[model samples]
Target: MSVPFALFTHCGIYEARVQDTFFVADQPLDDGNGNPPAGWGNPYQSGTITVTGQRAVFHDDLGHTVTFHERPGATSFLKLCA
Candidate 1:
């Protein structure tokens, strides 16, 4: 089961598509301040997603990872792609 989704953090927006064993993103992870961390090159890149329970872990190709926690009953203006 593969799911394509978008992720928005304090850093920036990312478009990601899930695969059989992993997921890939269309951009490099940001530093949550709208800038890439030190030693990062190219704004566009790919990554992997690891979902465990209610959390989603994004592992970037640059060796950086970010974890997002699920918020129950959270509301969003964005809609999932059909």
Candidate 2:
């Protein structure tokens, strides 16, 4: 099979690191359906993240914003066979 864009694995993604003009959010950002900010984006390196209620808003320095909310019951399950 080909590679998945989200790159989810057994360890799962735990953080979203931002530096200069780059950013990364390693989590199930939204519902499994097609959505923006579902994984990664560009030109959103430095900015601020505001969390209120069940929503998290990501604003970039370039005047762009991405409101993020994890899907309900979103999780990673691993099954290892020896």
Best by lDDT: 1
Q: Quantify all predictions' global Cα lDDT against the true fold.
A: 0.46, 0.37
- List model 1 lDDT by residue over 29-64, tens digit each: 556676545555444335555666555666655576
RMSD (Å) of each candidate, 1 decimal: 8.0, 12.3
Q: Ten consecutive residues with minimal summed lDDT in candidate 2?
A: 1-10
Tell me how many residue pairs clash in candidate 2. Answer: 0
Residue 74 local lDDT, model 1: 44
Deviation from truth (RMSD, Å), model 2: 12.3
Model 2 alpha-carbon drift over 4 Å, by segment: 1-44, 76-82
lDDT of 2 at 72: 40
Per-residue error for 25 in candidate 2, Å, reads 12
TM-scores for all predictions: 0.44, 0.36
Candidate 1 structure, TM-score to reference: 0.44
